[model samples]
Target: MSADIPATYTAARPAATAEVSRQAWLVWLTSERRAARLTVETYGRDLAGFLGFLTRHLGAEPTLADLARLTPADFRGWLAEAAADNLSNATRAKKLSAVKSFLRYVERDHGIAVAAIGLVATPRARKPLPRALTVIDARAIATEIGEVSDVAALQARDTALFTLLYGCGLRISEALSLDRGQAPLPGSDAPLRVMGKGGKTRIVPVLPLAREMMARWVALHWQPAGDAPLFLGARGKRLDAAIAQKSLRTFRRQNGLPEHATPHALRHSFATHLLAQGADLRAIQDLLGHASLSTTQRYTEVDTAQLMAVWRRSHPRA
Candidate 1:
């Protein structure tokens, strides 16, 4: 029953040459890859942790030449240390990905190829199934979420935003990124052209109710014109994601909704509901703008689990 001891490792400081490469990679991540600030910082920490492990394992400061000489065993030792820390497989996997990304950058950009790093197997991280709202709950969020807001415009905004999310299966980022000109009109049959992840665009049909609500909100929007944001903040600027999430959190808290009731959950509900209604998995993938069909297949697991739950509740054999 003794607690696991911490690894007695210190990160080896990089030589000036290696340090220059690391800094340059970080800069490239920011400017060229357009990585988020948090991602850059997290990858920086992961790399630092790997270097720390190398310091202890190799008993010396790591140079660019040392990086080029790293073996699969060396990478495994670092992963072992992370495992010793009780980090989940997902976290370990992300750490490995960060190290691999750094090594790839070093090889490509600085001509320091660590070919042995490629021999190391990546950690298998089990992604949790997406949590979706029931059909009643999803519809309630779209129609009644506005009750939490007193201001007429805010109420209308909440209704329209949730409606669009549930109807169109958009990620919050995708929905928030919409320009005023892209807003679906009340009576139009035009499919929405959404710029999804990786700068890929997909067309999603808007629900008539969603369009009607969107048109209502647009009518009340201040300066709703060419190239302006589709959804405006209280200060007439583009609405922040945090603000939208907070609005939903407030609504859920007030309405006795489950903690899983989030804007993204509405998207999940959209997919799940469509699946229940016999929508094709590939078609759902296109609607959600998922690059992979496997990603869309997770909803099938969710649907199966729900059916099992219903069976448990209603079947006579139990």
Candidate 2:
């Protein structure tokens, strides 16, 4: 949370003491909720914004007692104030959500139910579809990344990385976090364990083609065993994702692929391609390590569009 808005109450100890519950709730979010770093950071900022407003609005530190008596009008005033400060509806909505969550925590931990917060509704926002590459384009990009590099080792490393992006459906961070011990033996069919968002681990089945490429790359490169990084920078440290992103960016630009041709685009293509092949949404969710099935269902939209395109192009009735 930004420290700028402390507009602190004169009774510093009272204010600070009253804030202990918030800290405890944050700890619960970390340990029990397993909230992502960005989620925790955003929630903290939203709560800080609310508390800062209360300091100004109430002319005193807000206690749990103060929170309990807040009417719907008080909530509306807070949203209105945030709007006057030019916070977008999306941001105001997020702030309200954080405040609501904090109050719910207070209710659970301290028996102070701020049920009024439930009356506030979130602002609706348009959801965008995931951008996915066509199967041909995804394969072409991976093949080019492997073959087009100047150095043999670098070529092999990049090939393995891109292959994982497409073949294993790994997020760039997940793929780059791989170590030497993760390299499956040639022709081995064991599943690869990937630690994804929010520190959740999921097992991903390795395609034989992906395994072959990975084994061949390991054979041609350094760090085949022990705990060194599976992919390396020029200095031989664990590879930075920016380098991988840059490599993809350069390849896309040269190959005339769309600008969205990113490492993540490979992952989008992974799920979309799977959905196109009639894979179950639940299975894809498991492979992508998504906590919500709705997140995986976005690929259905992509697949539907592709099906429409094929129908338009190939059907005689069209």
Candidate 3:
């Protein structure tokens, strides 16, 4: 929970000796692989854990040669050690993923065979359903956000941002990255073009309420340029996603909402509410910009569960 990143201590230089390959792998992961900083740190720890186990099992430090010569038994031993240490299935799976990724890189770049790594079975972990807010709670949260402050720009900005999320089913990143032209939510009833994950562009209809809120925010715009950022921070810079998330976190705390009331929940609520109203599954998938219909299918399960709950509450055959 500290402000300092845990991996800062583990950050090291690539040496010309035994650590040369590990450092090279780290460098490639960061530079070319486009891996996040946290990924580099956690993957580094997983590798370190693997090497530490190898040292105890083989009575020495593992060199690149030792890694290339590693057998399936060595990997099984490492997995067994992780299991004995009571690592959760999720943690174990992540560690295994890191190892596999590193070995895959070694195989491709260093010409080292990673057949043993490929044989390792990934640990199965349960996937939790995304927590979505109820329609009343989602609307209440949005209404409450606008009243949080007296500043017109801040109030309008928060209101517009939350409305875009619930009304349009946009990801936080997609919403935050919006320029005025890219996500023009004001003065238009047409579909707004949104660039989602993997550079896929999808056009989503703009709700009238969201458009009205956006009109309020744009009036206080500093530049009034078409291409300027739609949302601005305290200093008039493009709004940081954390600021919006923190605002929601504070709102949830103040209103006695559940812990799962996050910024992303608004998007989930958009989908769940639509599905509950008898929207087509495929249409919901397209509206939410989901590439796979299966991802959108989760809302069906949520709706069905809600239906069963309602039936139980209202049924006379108790």
Candidate that scores best on TM-score:
1
lDDT of 3 at 280: 95
Which scores better on lDDT, 2 or 3?
2
Instruction: Give every collision pair in model 2.
Output: none
Q: Could you tell me the TM-score of candidate 2?
A: 0.61
- Which digits, one per residue and each the tens of the lDDT, describe model 3 over residues 33-55? 89999989988889878878888
Q: Write the per-residue lDDT of candidate 1 for residues 1-318, one digit (tens) a residue.
A: 234633321122234355566777899999999999999999998888888788788787678889988888988888988999999889999999998899888777656689888799988888988999989889999999899888999998989999999999999999999989999987789999999989999999998999999988998984537689999899988999999999999988988889999999999999999999999999999999888999999999999999999999999996
> How many residue pairs clash in model 1?
1
- lDDT by residue for model 2 (2-118), tens: 565454322222333346666777888999999998898888878878887887888977887788878887888889898899887788888888888888877666667776777
User: Candidate 2: where are CA atoms >4 Å away?
Assistant: 1-122, 310-318
Q: What local distance difference test score does each model get? A: 0.88, 0.82, 0.81
lDDT of 2: 0.82
TM-score per prediction, in order, is 0.64, 0.61, 0.62
Predictions: Cα RMSD each: 11.7, 12.1, 12.3
